[model samples]
Target: MKIALNGRPLTDQTKAAIQALLGELARRGAEVQINDAYGQTLQEWGVMHPFTSLYTSRADLFDADFVFSIGGDGTLLETVTHVGERRLPIVGVNTGRLGFLATIKPEEIAQTLDWLENGNYSLDERVLLHVENDRDVFEGTNFGLNDFVVTKTDRSSMIVVHTWLDGEFLNSYWADGLVISTPTGSTGYCLSVGGPVVLPRTNNFIIAPISPHNLNVRPIVVNDSSRIEVRVESRSKNCLISLDSRSKVVDDSIRFTVRKEKFGAQLVKVKGDTFLETLRSKLNWGLDIRN
Candidate 1:
């Protein structure tokens, strides 16, 4: 089995964990192809690895079988972008807090790798949001596995986002920002802004406002197939638009539209692990205070 590894900067904190991962993969005879950035980090740290090759550009991932995302959820999100429309199955190794998305633990590395080798896993196909703008915002990598956000830049006053669903006019939101999150991302920014926890496989998009001026305005769930359009009217000359972790400041005059990408992300989940299990564990649902 061939695995492509990509992650954030390496630190002394995560060194042992990574070493164990490399040693185990080498022991199991699984081919490891690491990203250039991560490869450089490993070399700089004098961490011995068994990586067969280094891949830099996303196009270079053609020969990879599985994309292993190391670090945190942020790294996994970036890996999703790099995977693009190839639909490669991704396994995330969490080395950060919260870990709402990166579910793998360091302690379970050996067991998890064994399961991966023996084909004891399922794929969780996650919907991706594709952003369209006048001048190709985010350029080639304009899709995200999570939510799309339009927020005010810095301390700029609240922005008014005129929203439309399937070409029909929706309400104009007067708030700090707006978040159109996928069901997979319902627990992220959407949850922080009072959105409901939606099932990951649900074919819907949750439109949630960030601190809306009108208390009555509530987050709404829309069909994933529906087209979403927004025109921003902010006091500041420029506002921020983001696809998951990637954010850029653009002129408020830019009109934006969001839609489901043609191809989705495939997250590899080992058997016995379910989304409900993760959700309940992460959210601490049904836990008694006295327990």
Candidate 2:
């Protein structure tokens, strides 16, 4: 099988796990294509491998059986941009704090790979928000697996975001920022700001204000079919716009519209590893904390 690999710098513990995984894949005669930056990092850390090729960009990627994202959720997000519309089933190995997306364990890499080869996994397709703006930033890849965010720049006062749902006036948000979160991302920024934790397949978008001036403003859940648009009025004449981990600073003149992307991200889930189980473990749910 062919495998494409991408990752971030390794931790002291995960380094050894990566070495073992590479050796196992080589022994199994699997073809490996690694990201150039990650390959450099591995070489620096003395993790040798029999690599078929190095992928510097999305153009270097071909049809592979799987894409291994070996780091935190940010690395997985970067891998998504690399895979782009090809939408390879991604397996994320967490080596960062609070890994909301990258759930696979490093030690279980060998077993999980075997499971994948034997068709013992399922694919979870997730929604991504697409951004349209007057400025040609983001280089044509304008979708994110998480949420679309607009926040005031550092030291800037709170901004006013005039929002509309499918051309109808929604609300004028007088807040530090606004978040348009997908159900798959309900556990991310939305949850941090008192938004509801929604199931991944709900196909709904949550509009949550960040530190609103009016305390009565609450998060609103809207159907994914609706198009959401926002116009910013900032004292600094600038605001920060983010699609997942990627962000840019732009002026208020840029018209912004966010909608569900045409294609979705594909996450690989091994049998027995369910989302409910992940929540129970990751969030420490159902654990007794009483002393």
Candidate 3:
């Protein structure tokens, strides 16, 4: 089996885990490839392996059967850029705080790999958002597994976001920002702002305001099939637009539309692991404080 590895900067703890994982893979005779940037980081840390290939671009990962994302959820999100439309299955290893997407811990690596090798895993298809704008933005890869955020820039006051669903008027949100999240992202920024936690297969999108001026304004859930159009009015000429972890400054005049992407992100899930289990562990759900 051919596997690809990608990650952000690693700490000592993560490096040790990665080393162990690589050693196990080598012993099993699996062909391994590392993202070029991550390979350089490994070399800097004096962790070199003769059996691994280093790939510099997305095309280099085309032949990979699976891509292991090491680090936090942000690292996994970055891996999406490399996978693009390839729909590669990603296994996220948690080495950072609040790893909602990167569910597997370092201690579980060996067991997880064993399951992966024996075909004891399933693919969880997570929906992605395809962003459209009047001008070129976010390069050509405009799909995101999480939410798309539009907000005011630093030093600027709260902006007004005029929203529409399927060309019908929604509302003018007077707030710090707005979040349009997929069901997969409902647990993320959407939840922080009081949005409902949606199940993965809900086929819905969440519209939540960030610090809305009106106290009565509440988050709303909409059908994923609906096309969302947004226009921003900010005192500052620019606004901040972010897709998952990537962000850029854009003119307030830029019209934006978001819809469900044609393809979804494929997440690897081994048997006995469930989303509810992750929620309980990560969010301390059902913890008995009185105990």
lDDT of each: 0.90, 0.90, 0.90
* Consecutive 10-residue window with the lowest summed lDDT within model 3: 48-57
lDDT of 2 by residue, 1-291 (tens): 998999898878888888988998899999999999999999999999888999998888978889999888889988998988898999988777777788888778888988988999999999888889877778788999989999999665899999999999999999999999999789889999989999899989999999999999999999998899999999999899998889999998887899989989999998677889888888988898772
Give lDDT tens digits, candidate 1, residues 162-249. Answer: 9999999999999999999999999899999999989988899999999999999999999999899999998877888889999999
Q: Please give each candidate's TM-score.
A: 0.97, 0.97, 0.96
lDDT of 3: 0.90
Candidate 3: Cα lDDT at 273:
67
Per-residue lDDT over 71-186 for candidate 3, one digit per residue giving the tens place of the 0 to 100 score? 99999988988898899999998988889999988999889988998999999999999999978688887989889999899755889999999999999999999999999899
Clashes of each: 0, 0, 0
lDDT (Cα, 0-100) at 75 in candidate 2: 90
lDDT of 1 at 191: 95
**Residue 49 displacement (Å), model 3:** 2.6
Compared to the true structure, candidate 2 yields what TM-score? Answer: 0.97
Model 1 poorest 10 in a row by lDDT: 57-66
